[model samples]
Target: MKKLFSFLLLAFMVVNLAHAQQDPQALKILNQMSQKYKSMNAFKATFTQTLENPSAKVKETMQGDILVSGPKYRLAVSGQEIINDGKLMWTYLKDVNEVTITENDAEAESMSPSKIFDMYKKGYKYALAGTEKQGAETVDVIELAPEDRSNPIFKVRLYISQKDKTLKSWQMFRNNGNRYTYSINNFVANPTLASDTFSFNKAKYKGVSVVDLR
Candidate 1:
């Protein structure tokens, strides 16, 4: 679940491909997608995450929502709520009624939400995989591979709408044969956000145990 949440936080990585291995067509689409998201002041999105492991005969699905404003974000998924205020983070477990506070570690986050649309400037090689139909809309499929062979994620596939360049879905394939796919159901650009949106509100979670790890 932690791994799933981490990938969700990173989301999509796009833009600035100077590598010879990178495909020109893919770069153009990625740059456009990056600019589209970068132009937004804040956004809210609802998504569905699907996890599958054929060997283990396991399949699970969860619905979640996220609010992002620059480096700060609030995410609720799979019975867990994570709030990061750019400086600190509060992770609340719904079942246990516990919240753990820790200092935000940017270096530890390989791909932070704020930089999601442009983090592909290094450590990745991407190319245009092809095009496919997503529902009634046609989408351009872009495939991303990590330059570091040691990376657990062997490949990441992104489905971007050809008409608007909006991200429709993305899939991550791990070396262990576990596949994680996330589909964006709804997205609102530049939504009105409250002051406390990126911070955990203990008052709302009555009698919640606080574990300050900072």
Candidate 2:
């Protein structure tokens, strides 16, 4: 009985030790990338977003440009534009010539251009998945699983350039087996952006309908 008790205790200790050994390398790289992005005053990027679902046999791709300055951002896609001025958000639908205005809820976890950089800081367990070569650069792939299992998003994969510590791409895996991928084609750091770049000027769009949902 004594020998059996000692073996059980040893096994418990080993299990506890293994559980305590979380990888710090992945967290370090993510922190470095976040710091580099936070240091920049403003930036612009052209990106391609792809949504795919193998089970549903659906795939769609769209190209867009984003201008971000702090919490404010203007995202212009093919048929729509989203402008957030830190307090209010305006989503303009070019097809309908209408704009929906709503309050920008800061408490929500948004995957917008301004919030994407530091998104891994909360509600996630991240680890360095692996490394892969993309074109001429080697990228570090980090995998993040949401702590809340009930969350719609199951996993998020971030690809960071190993050379410049810049984010190359990120992919989101949804609970419904749908995946969304965003890849940056071009990036300009600390660009001379206008002060009103993030705001929606209603006068600019002549004869447009506005729907206020705020």
lDDT of 2 by residue, 1-214 (tens): 9868985885564334334434599889999899888999988999999999976999999999999888989899989999998999999999999999999987662667788888777767777878999899999998777666677876788999999899999999886868999999999999997757888888899999999998
Off by over 4 Å in 1: 1-20
Can you give the TM-score per candidate against the true fold? Answer: 0.87, 0.88
The per-model lDDT (C-alpha) reads 0.84, 0.85
Worst lDDT 10-window in candidate 1: 11-20
Model 2 spans > 4 angstroms off: 1-22
Q: Report the lDDT tens digits of candidate 1 across residue range 1-214.
A: 9888865554443323213377889889999998888788888999999999977898999999988887888889999998988999999999999999999998665555565666566778988878999899999998887777677877788899999988898888887879999899999999988878898889999999999999
Clashing pairs in 1: none
Alpha-carbon lDDT of model 1: 0.84
